[model samples]
Target: MDFTLSGQQRDRCASVLARTQTAFPAGPGDHQPTASASAYTRAEWSRLADLGLLGASVPTAEGGGGLGALDTALVFESAGRGCADTGILFAAAAHLFSCGMPILDFAPPDTRKRLLPRMCSGELIAGNAMTEPESGSDVARLTVTARRVADGFLLSGTKSFVSNGPVADVFVTYATTDPQAGHLGVTAFVVERGAPGLAVGQPLDKMGLLSCPAAAVTFDDCFVPDEQVLGAPGQGGAIFQHSMRWERSCLFAVYLGVQQRLLDRCVEHVRQRRQSGKRLAEFQSVSNRVVDMKLRLESGRLLLYRACDALDRDDPDASLWVSLSKLAVSEAAVASSLDAMQLFGGRGCLREEGIEAAVRDALPTTVFSGTSEIQRQLIARSIGL
Candidate 1:
């Protein structure tokens, strides 16, 4: 498994990194900003679109660059290193998940023809709505229901933690068509923003990724035409499972970039800072701590790349490998950030240096996508333990 990037992928990464560095420089005074406000930079978003970074995974036939998972991960990692802004990267991922992949995978011919072109152009923001208030990881227990109407289905219930929720133009949502049939009864639908009874709730405040606005969406007898159903009515669970496999596997690529950035800062600080007439790196303990940081970052990167390769090849162990990657990358990110703060010492605790902000940003890694405990359980199940 060669982890080396192809020349084209390397060039793309360099291009994205240059753009991100200019657009999202570190600000003053622990002054992190959420992406929801007018302060959120759509100019950067538009720049990414213009660079064709937004649709790297979509096929060329669908107006994209036709890159694969590895290429997409390279672009995401570059973005992460350049900007700690979670909102922009997560929004891009959400678009690929809800719009790009699904349209390519399951959309009827006319639906795909209508939606894919605009999505590739970045004119349409898309979201995936799966988590209900009561049913998050336990997707089988979701209570959102869709009863059949004359032309389509009447969708009713609420979905929470929807990424790109507040401003998304389309939602790839799920609901139960038969209440008693469990997961098999689930169905997927594409709900347009202005559908008769669809409403975007107020954005939820979060600990980290403040820039990525997340909110609840309510469907009050929302009318979804038959044409909007993603696949066959009973196939929603399969579609969702497939989506999660990709999400859990690849979502951490950008976070891995963040880990690399944090590691670099630690290395720079230790090389220059002094303690008791010796540089920080001269102290064995300090040097060992930095070594640990480097170790974690490298290991996490390997796991992520391994997962990406497995996904690219459609390997049988893809799901298991992805679970391992997600677990390793998320935990390593938090650990590396904490180490960065410690290495920075007094300056790290202060908000002005941006170390504290990195710590705050890293806090969410353990909870989102899937929790550490959940990942362990999945790993256990994979090995038949």
Candidate 2:
């Protein structure tokens, strides 16, 4: 019931924000820069690992911080506040919530002992491969298939828009084992990058979050041992849903941080910048827009925390709150970014100001982690409409 952070939690949040700001300082020249070689550098990944952020949600036994869902959201929010490059944060969230959590929860102990530590240590990276060309939001339409083999399975399919795919050491993907069984027939597997017949396509040219590399992954009879199978057969649906709930509830906190940062910048700008010999803050229209931004930021944070709390308590209605939080935070991010851009006048349109980049980054928030439309549909369905 209490939303206030404990002193220890406050210290963790401050430490993470300070470290992230130090590591990824924002500058005028730093706007919209593309990753030339790798999606993210090993050194950067190591820094996050050093901060214990990469493993914040992981159990201590698995070489992680063992933080719960609410604490994990705090970590992400702080990171988002400090890190100018939301791409890396986005990539890390995908790794933890989408790929790593499912494996941590559903994988066999042997598999966990083998991979989780490395993943937590930043020695290895993981990617989630669920979306396909024909299947984005709809899991039942997936075309990927996995055939049983002697000691393992043969997977044949292509997964599109896979975040961190280009550099991932392992992948948690889903494929149909019994097409007739529909969603129940789908199975999940943890496939290594070195698995035979696994091919990663060139990174997709993206509109924003350029530092987070996404690619299409093709599995041509890829071999996965029985030990790599996540849970039992026909369990992929549940596993995917479990990971997605974590993602939808916790990962969206990053946007909350981003919006906070944007709000801070806009507030400072309005106070300092003058128009017609008056501070921008003195203008009713300008001040009202800033007020709206503040309102959205605070409101979104409430929904986000509520969802995260529900997740921590294992509430049955957690999905509803998660969807509400996701939809609110995402749309708020985009709206606040636009308000920031407009308030900045011509400077916002310029790349050097970083405002335009924020818009581009915010644009996709509604699309990923389940689209805003999908979230609305889920919310309505939950309400018995």
Candidate 3:
């Protein structure tokens, strides 16, 4: 019930936010032409690694800060507020929550021992590969196969729309070992990069989050040694769902930070810009819209932090909270971004102003980490409706 951040958490967020603002280099020229590919330059990526952000949620024993769920959310919220590139922010979230946590919790002990330290140190980048061309939201029906081999499993299939795909050094991905067994047939693996048969496709052009490159990954009889298997052979479904709980709860915190930043920008613009000797903020129409944005943000923050607490406590309604939190924050981001753009007028439409870019990044929130429709369905089921 007490969602106020601890003093230590506040300090951590401040430190992270200050550093994030200065990390990204300015665009090539004063007049930025268009959204570039969401590629992570080595320098920016290294700077992130140096900040210890890559390992914020990992345990200190594994070279991380060992922050709890609330602390981790706070840190990411800070990053979202100042980071110039949504792709980088998105990749960081995917790396920390979607890819890293699953491996830390479910991978074989030897695999964890081998990967966690490097991943935490930023020596390696990790990606979660679950979406397939044929099965976007249906995990049970994935066609990717992990066939038994002499000493391990031979993985063969394509994982599409893989965030961090172009640059990942390891993947916490899924495949089915027994198609006839339905969900019970699913198996997860820690597939390392450069495994002979594994190949990354060209980066896909996206509407937003241009700084983070996404690509398809094809596994052609890629051998995953026995030690690389995560959990049991038939438990990948549960493992994937467990990771999604973390992603849906905390990942949207990035959007929260972004929305807050946009709100501040709009407030500043309206107060200073005058119409017929009256400031825009003085107009009831503009002020009312701003208040609405604020209300959505405050309410959504409550839901998100509560969901993080629920996950920490392993509450019975943890799943429901996660779904609600994801839905609230994501929808709020898309709506708030639009308000920010409209308030800024023509400048908002310009690619160089960065307001429209936020809208583009916000658009995908409802689709990934489960759609808004899926969240509502889950909530309906929880109350026996």
Candidate 4:
């Protein structure tokens, strides 16, 4: 498979990078979250939509850019490189891959017709609600229940750590329909924000990615019509897995962009900064660290591109490739960020330098979108472990 991007793809990447630079020109200080500013404002979100980033992967008929997995990954990487606020990028990825993808792929035509345009236009924001307080990775153990009702279903449960929860207009959530069926009992539904008995709790304070507001969402016998159901009953597991494959394959490309930007800064710093009458770049130790950062970035990028290729081809080994990609990129991001901090010295420790914030942002990459450990487990299973 040719991993080389076509001329058109290169142009798209350049366009996205230019747009992100114009849309978010602020440095790390201006981008930092305040008590009153925890997430992207409506205007900023709209700006992103205008850039065609919010709908990069959705079908063109649905008012989206109709980008495939590889193209989508390239768009995200460009955004990461241009935008200093990783939190907003993270929020966008969750909204697109984790929430919008399932509805686009599995929801009824009517539902898709109604939601996709609004979602693509930035008129509505969506969230994924799968993780409960009790169930993180284990979908079968989710306590959320969806009981069949006369009209549809009545959902009751609490979802913890919902990205974009505080501002989401709708959510693609999962609930257990038959407790006896294990994972098969789980079902997916698109629940609106103002549905009766549906409540969004206060935003949760996070150590990083604060610009992406997360909160607990509770459904107290919330009613949902059959039309809102995504895929058939008992297909929630597969649907969720499908969305995650998209996420793991493409979402981490954002980190690649982040790493690239960080590496650029480190190279500039080492070349300009000096010690003992010689530039930092002249020191083998300092130069080696920068080399390692470059190594990780390029290597991780290949794995990411390969994963995206696997997804595009619908390869049976897609999961293995995705897990490998996610693990490599996430780990590389954290390691490169730390190295950047060290290279920056005392300045890096300061919030203003943005180096520390980079570390904080990179730290969570390994945890979200399934942990590094879970990816390893999937990889092990693929190898007959």
Candidate 5:
């Protein structure tokens, strides 16, 4: 399969990269001392929205660009190379995965008409509320409950580790309407911010991705109108599953750009730095490490491109390919980041230099959107092994 990007896609990627470099330069103060540090740059977010890059993957019918997953991934990869703020990319990926695709695929007409336009215009921010305190990877075991009410449904539950929870204008939340039905009992609802009895909890301190705010959300008899329900009752599991597949597959394209940056830095460093009267690249050990980094970087890109192709084709094996791509890209990114840090020696550890920050930021790739172990299990199931 020819993985070369089309000429138009290449131009789009170049444009985004140029804009991001000029508008969002990495700074010494970019490193956060606290885990709960607000990492999003409102101006940058607005700029991306204005460019219509925020809605690149949404359908054109909804006022979006209607770009495919591959195009979106390329844009994200470019952004990652240019910006140190991971929060912006995370927010975009979350919005596309949770709100853009699912709503386009399954939402009722009125709901779509009301939400998609604002989302396309970048006037609204959306999040996914899935992980409960008791249930992280186990979607079937979620304890949050929603009971049928006269007008809509009374939702009462707590969702933990919610991305963009504090600032989200809307949330795609999952709850159980009938615990006895297990996965079949779950349903999805669009919960607007500031709705009655809804509260955003304190933001959690995380080890990495400091810019992407994560918090717990509590719904205490919060009423969601029947019209707000996504898909239908008992379809939450399927929706969640599909959303996660997309998230895991395409979200790391941004990191691909980061890997490219690291590779360039490594190349420059080895060429310019001398060790024991010889350039760093002359040393067999240094050359081998650089080669390893290149291998990981190239292979990761291939996996992502393959996954994107599968998605575009609407292939039946798309889910398996996506899981594999997620596993490959995330783990490879972590390895590449670590290798880059090691190649830089003590300079990489210095906070102001940004290598340490890259390492820290890459740490979360393996844990979110379903952990690495979960990906392995899914892949295993696909092969019936």
Candidate 6:
């Protein structure tokens, strides 16, 4: 399979990087300020909208770029590289790929028509609330419940670790309509922010990606109209699975960009920073670590690109490939960040150099999307374990 990007794709990537670079926030000194109070500030939000990033994957008929999976990977990877502020990048991915894509794909006509246009215009922010307090990777076990009413459904329970939660205008949420049916019971819904009983908690002060605010969302007898149900009552598990395919396959590309950025900065640092009357790059240990970072970077790119290509091609192994790619890229991100920290030594630990931030950002790779442990189990099962 060929992995080279097309001319148009390269141009698209370059263009995206340019806009993202201009708008992303830069931390002054040691303290990193989030681009805004929430995951997105209006200024950067408009810039992304103006750049056509908000709708990169929407169909042209929907007033979007109408790009495919590979195009999404390309655009976002560039966005990740252009902005060292991975928080904004993460917020962008959660909105477009994780939350928006599913709504566009599975939501009813009225629901999509009401939300997607504004979402693409950056007038609306969406969050996917999948992980519950009790169940993270074990998505089938979430306890949130949805009961049908004359008007629609009354949803009750809490969703935890919701990325983009604090600032979301709408949520693509899941709740079980029938606890006995297991995965089949979970139903997906498009719950607007002002719905009667939906309340968003204060943004969690996370260890990394401070700009991308996360929070717990509570639905205490919240009413969702019938039109807002995505797909059907029993199909939420399927919808969530579909969204995960997009999230794991595309969102992790941000890490690919981060790893590349880390490598670039490290190379520049070692070449310029001196030790023992010689450049840091002259030392075998430092040089070898750089080599290892390169190795992980290329491997990650290959895995992600291959998974993307497989999805575009509709290959039978697409799911397996996506899981593998997510695993590889996420793990590589953590590994490469460590190497960057090691190479920078004292400065790596210092918040001012931005090296420590990368490490903190990369640390979450193992936990989100799918944990490294979950990925391994899924990969094994996919290959006939």
- Off-target runs (Cα >4 Å) in candidate 1 are 28-31, 34-41
Instruction: Arrange candidates by lDDT, descending.
Output: 4, 2, 3, 6, 5, 1
State TM-scores per candidate: 0.94, 0.98, 0.96, 0.98, 0.95, 0.96
Q: Lowest lDDT 10-mer window, candidate 4?
A: 29-38
Cand. 6 TM to true fold: 0.96
For every model in order, what is the number of clashing pairs?
1, 0, 4, 0, 1, 0
Can you give the lDDT of residue 177 in candidate 4? 94
- lDDT of all predictions: 0.80, 0.90, 0.86, 0.91, 0.83, 0.85
Q: Per-residue lDDT of 238-284 in model 6, one digit per residue for the tens?
A: 88888888889788998888888889989999999999899999999
Candidate 2 structure quality by residue, lDDT tens digits, 147-251: 999988999999998999999999999999999999999999999999999999989989888878999999999999999999999999999989988898778
Tens-digit per-residue lDDT, 251-290, candidate 4 = 8999999999999999999999999999999999999999
Q: How high a TM-score does candidate 2 get?
A: 0.98
- Evaluated at residue 5, the lDDT of candidate 5 is 76
Q: Per-residue lDDT for 1-385 in model 5, tens only?
A: 5767789988888888888877677667334334535657566567767656668788788878788887778888888877777666777788877667787777888998899878877788788899998998889988889999887899998998788776788889999998999899999889889799899987777777767777899999999998888899889999888888678877888888878888888999999989899999999988998998889888888888888888889989888888888898889889988988888898888877677778888888998888999999999999998
Model 2 error, position 56 (Å): 1.1
Give candidate 4 regions above 4 Å deviation.
28-31, 34-36
Q: Report the C-alpha displacement of residue 83, candidate 1, in angstroms.
A: 1.6
Measured by TM-score, how close is model 3 to the native structure? 0.96
Cα RMSD (angstroms) for every candidate in the order listed: 2.0, 1.3, 1.9, 1.3, 1.8, 1.8
lDDT of 2: 0.90
Segments in model 2 whose C-alpha atoms lie over 4 Å from true places: 29-32, 35-38
